[model samples]
Target: MSGSTFALRVAQGVGFTGAAWLSGNIAALSANSVPAIISSVREDNISPNVACKQWRNMYEAGKTQNPPIAFATASSFAYVAWSVRQIPRSLAASAAYGGFGMYVAAAVLTLSIVPYTVAAMRPTNNALLELAESKGDRVTSSAEVEGLLGRWTTLNWARSLLPLAGGFAGIAAALL
Candidate 1:
């Protein structure tokens, strides 16, 4: 209900959506490789026409033969690429909706952190004020403020990490 609390909620919502979009972009780039991989996978004699007709002709002539070799000649990378390609279009489609969901979730998450941040800041601010009022005199109370700030910093960092990790996981899951 406080101004800071409201601001935190808004920030969280924005951060979450930003994270999701970032993830989606990564997934999109990865997914784009799928079509190429599919083409490459089919490049073998098994499906000469899976890719370009020019390559098919070369295959028929025995001039060159190998899977179109997407990602790399390495099967594992190829498989990873293929896996990336396999991410359902529906998921991507749903990502559009998921974006909104992320925003809401982020907002809620951020809002939840407000009270904790406020609590942390209160002691820190008090110490800071006390130190300032002392006018150059050393103040032991500054340590409490510093500690609270450190805790807040750690939590903020954690908040950032969650969306990043979640986004990557979502992308990986989609790829699989």
Candidate 2:
């Protein structure tokens, strides 16, 4: 019922929604034929087979991206909540140990936010590379420069803020 618990629930809900959306997209792509994929890719102005390949590649890249870090931070926040819940019913000896445990848990939880933020901020080079290749452009400043710059700039902006927001959340969790 506390604010941190509410925030953690929100984070979990968002994560689940994202995971579901990604899974659904993957399934839809998988069920489509090669030609369908190719046509879709071409319609999007990307290379042949890039749709299927990029889908799988991006998914793999995300495995090492922001989601895992967010999940870890959320999990740690949940643990902190549980630890706080334990404090009131504890005996003197139990209170001391439990309080120490809670502090440790909070610190660990806070520490986890850093990695999550870092992961979120870090650009997915694989995605960028695939996009670059699909465009058949050597330098990003070519005729297809807009596409290249757009993608990179969008990702860069996301990376810049993710860590800061994550760190703020971690500090908030610790304070809670």
Candidate 3:
């Protein structure tokens, strides 16, 4: 009814939608794409260079697409927190506080994947990128590509969890 109420609803909707989309997108890469790339090497007898190139393409796509989703989701969650904080505490003090806290948590969790990618995933990413670009010059063996893909898959799954949790947090905020 009120403008702030409408804003909170909109923010919550955006936050939840974005989080779900982002998390699922990243997880799909980990679960499906990366594994298929790995299989292309191990089972399909594809060249390591080819597999590396495929991975690089996937990486580039995710790099271009995922960050914007993360930024939007985190921003929406933060906006939700801010909007909830503006509500008069006298009207519903406990719910307002709880919602604010949950929304803040959601924002933090959604944003954390950036640092996680930087700290945990970057080394493997760089190595794989170099191997992809090197076109067999840098690669020591197929095992190297396999190892890198496995590591990336694990790290990406971990990365997906943050947004998943953030989405759940946003849902909890809505219930509050």
TM values, all candidates? 0.28, 0.34, 0.94
Quick one: best lDDT, which candidate? 3
Candidate 2 per-residue lDDT over residues 47-76, each given as its tens digit: 433543554455456446545654554454
Residue-level lDDT of model 1, residues 111-167, one tens digit each, is: 332343356435543443444344334533323433433443444444334345543
Clashing pairs in 3: none
Cα-based RMSD of candidate 3: 1.3
Selected candidate, larger lDDT, 1 vs 3: 3
Quote model 2's TM-score: 0.34
Deviating ranges (above 4 Å) for candidate 3: none
lDDT at residue 119 of model 1 (Cα atoms): 62
Residue 35 of model 1, lDDT score: 36
Task: Report the Cα lDDT for candidate 3.
Answer: 0.91
lDDT of 3 at 86: 88
